[model samples]
Target: MSRLATLIDEGNRPVVTAEFPSIDGGGLAAVEKAADELRPFVDAVNATDNPAAHAHASNTSIAIAMSQFGLEPIMQVVCRDKNRIAMQADIIGASLFGIQNIACLTGDDVTAGDEPEARRVFDLDSTQLVKVASGLAEGHYLSGRAIKQPPALFVGAVENPFAPPLDYRVMRALKKAEAGARFLQLQIGYYPERLENFVAGCVEHGVTRTTALIPTVVLTKSAKALSFMDESVPGISIPAEMIARVAGAGDKDAIAEESYQLTLELSRHALSLPGVSGIHLTDFRHDGSLERLVRDLRIGPAFAPDPVASASGTTSV
Candidate 1:
């Protein structure tokens, strides 16, 4: 089993995941640096394939690079560009290459990307993709055809609690869980109180016990970036106080420091919540901040709290 799967299956420990951009050539240097620096602190690295439908290196290639450096990779499979046949083939290919974890996403609309005129093939939504993955794991295809060797994978889905109709978000999560998602990585979270309430709702609906809920921790470097995310990003909600805190910072370095500190505080608060299996860290535009945070968390016991105790004093998976 992969280290992340083991961590989730065995329970007690909280898995730490960091996102790495899928790029090549000179851009790969930063990814390698992050993988090397975060090797000891992070449980797995998530590779994105041009998240906003922009152009970038393939996620599978990035996963290969991560595997080369002895790092576990969680491949993000977006349904925006591929059809069912292609996606199933990629799943088998990933398994053949020893990649076990998959994060299923419906993907942003083509209009949201650089190429608005590009044709999209959303043959399946995220929930349907989870079902496809589950079928693959069970030695069958979505068409009810049987496979000789089924892929052994840990399926994951994404959720956005900050999205409108909060009640619908929890129901969507439950639907994903029923569709065969074993874990859920939530959208960018800046409001801990809102996240806690969402997790509480998940517990109430029995989704927490069945699916591992992992909230995202996005690290912003400046007030400008925070404002942009609030305005441009579709489902993300950055607290007003957080933006004001960044705006009130003394200088660039101070803004970065404040952002990092706030991220750490949010991480700690997320860890304290019930039914939270882990935290996913995504640093936009500034990868060094993530590296610095991971290093600091590993340097001393002060920052590295016990996951078991922090997670509602229970070791249940």
Candidate 2:
């Protein structure tokens, strides 16, 4: 099993995961630099696929690079760019380089990217992709053809508990878990009541028993970032009051400080939840806020190692 899998199974401490900032340049050196920043604070990091419909490094290559650099990567595969065959190939190919974690997502529409003329491919949605990834891990293709040796993949998917049709979010989570998602990285949300109900529903329906629920919290430096997300980001919704709180906090430095505090509060609330197994961080600030937040919460592989079982052969995230 992967280190992340081992930690999730043991349920001893919170598993910390993060997004490896999309690499657009600097070759392998860029990947290394970003990995160094995140590796210490996270158990595993995601190599996102055409995030927000914009393209950069391929998910497979970034994931493979992260693995070589000693940072375990959750290879993110999106349905918006490739056909089912290509997606399977990316997952299988990354596994050849020791990439074990796969996070399936239904990417944003092509219209959301700079190159709006790009073709949009929705060969399969998120849940179907999860089932397909499970098939690959189990030693077969979707055609049911067998593999000589299947790669061990810790499969997972993303969820938006704060989105509309709120009551159905829990059911969606259960569906993903049943489809073989070992974990679910929730979208960044500001509403604690929604998160509370979402976690509770997961436990009630038995989603949390087998799968890890990792909620996402972003680290941003200003209120403009929050406003941008609230107005433009598709799935993320920030209450007007949250934006006002930071905006009304006075000058630039104070606004930034307030933003950090808001994030810290969210992190603490997430950690205190019972069925919650981990946290996913989306970093928007290069300042010391990331380190400070992790240090303050005292949750992550950098803070401590798992004492229950050392099967991971590495420190816990």
Candidate 3:
């Protein structure tokens, strides 16, 4: 089993995950540098698939590069650009290169990207993709053809607790888990109460018994960035008071500090939830705060309070 798979299965301490910055330029040297910076702070980082519907370096290429540089990658495969056949091939291809984790996503609409004219593809939804990946791991394709040797893939999908139809979010997570998603990386949100309710419901409905829940939090230095996500990002909503709290912090440095504190507070609260297994971070503060956040929380492999590997759902609160 992969370290992440073992960690989640053990359910001892908190797991830490982050998104790798999208690369449009720079060679392997650039990928190496990015991996080096994040390698010390996260158990595994996501190699995103055209995040926000904007194209960057291909997820496969970036994931392979990340592995070459000693950073484990959760290669994301989106259904927006590929059919089931292509997506399955990508998963199998990535596995050959030692990619152990796969995150399936129902990507943003084509209109969300820079090139609106690009045709959209949704041959399979996120839940179906999760099952497809699980099939690959089970040594068969959807067609029921057997593979002599199946790749061991740790499959997961995304969930958003803060989005509309709030009560149904837990059910959606349940669906993914039932579809064979081993983990669910939640979408970023500012509301603790909402997250609490979602996690509680997951536990109540028994979703946590089989699927690991990893809530996502963000590190942004300014309230404007928060406001932008609130207004522009789909499936993400932030309370005005939360934005005001950071905006009122005074100078730029003060605002940045306040933002970091906010993230730490959210991370703490998320970890405190009974069913939560870990935290997934989205860093907008390019200013070394990623390391700082991991160090402060003492949860990731490098900064954990204990030298031993932990998946105990216990984090420093």
Candidate 4:
């Protein structure tokens, strides 16, 4: 069994979840390769789509592939480009196909995705999406309709900790939780203090348990990519010094090694934080390097907190 399965079975124990990029961005074959690389320690796989992948909703192949690999799947369904009917159908189809975990997202704008010409259908935002999933779990449809059996899915939602007014993010998470979000994943983790603050904010909102996603950057700190990051990905800051550090490495392999090492260091920092239920390893489409990073670090679920340490009441970022 994978560490995730053991974590789940161990009853509320912290877990180490990894996100698997879907073949929709590259191809199914590429996804398979990434999966094979991460299979060693990857507990649960969250399959996401390309910015323009709303049209490929019919391509549920990733879920099937995950099952074939004996990996638990947390399928994400975005609502920006799908109407309620299509959303409902997809939800039911996913449940029928044995997808147990679902992440409801109010997807980004069409312009934000790869498909600019595609019209969006925001008939239901994340809040409504959560309600829909909860309703399905209760053996009912969103329209006051009933079903033969409720789907048994672990509903999840995402939050951006760096977003303005952190309180608003916490409030949104609370709404998701009220709407039946069983797990919460954050998108900001470049700094250890930021992660701790995010978790503390979650706890303050009465969230006793939620999965904290630690974002791992895989690209080398080259000048070209650093320039691209500044121009294209807003709110994504890669310091020049960090880039210079990577660029100053002995060679390309050394650069990759250092980047992965930084990721592992961040992982270790996140593991030390309290209320950090788990770490989500994100490769960000970096040539299957996450596999090597996990193996080298021997990454796994967080062990039980030491009572003696708790008595000392230690705290850090």
lDDT for each residue of candidate 4 in 111-155, tens digit (9 for 90 to 100): 765677887778999878988887888888878789887667677
List lDDT for all candidates, in order: 0.82, 0.92, 0.92, 0.64
Q: Candidate 1 residues 47-70, lDDT tens each?
A: 786688887878887887788788
Q: Which candidate do you rate higher for lDDT, 1 or 4?
A: 1
What are the runs in model 3 whose C-alpha is more than 4 Å off? 307-317
> Which parts of model 1 have CA positions greater than 4 angstroms off?
26-31, 285-288, 295-317
Off by over 4 Å in 4: 1-13, 24-32, 52-59, 209-230, 239-241, 248-251, 284-288, 301-317
The residue-by-residue lDDT of candidate 2 on 107-195, one tens digit each, is 98998889999989999999999999999989999999997799999999999999989999999999999999999999999999999
Q: Report how far off residue 218 is in candidate 4 (Å).
A: 4.9
Q: State every prediction's TM-score relative to the real structure.
A: 0.89, 0.96, 0.96, 0.80
lDDT of 3 by residue, 157-184 (tens): 9999998899999999999999999899
Clashes of each: 0, 2, 7, 0
Clashes by residue pair, model 2: 16-317, 43-317
Candidate 2 stretches greater than 4 Å from native: 305-317
lDDT of 2 at 243: 97
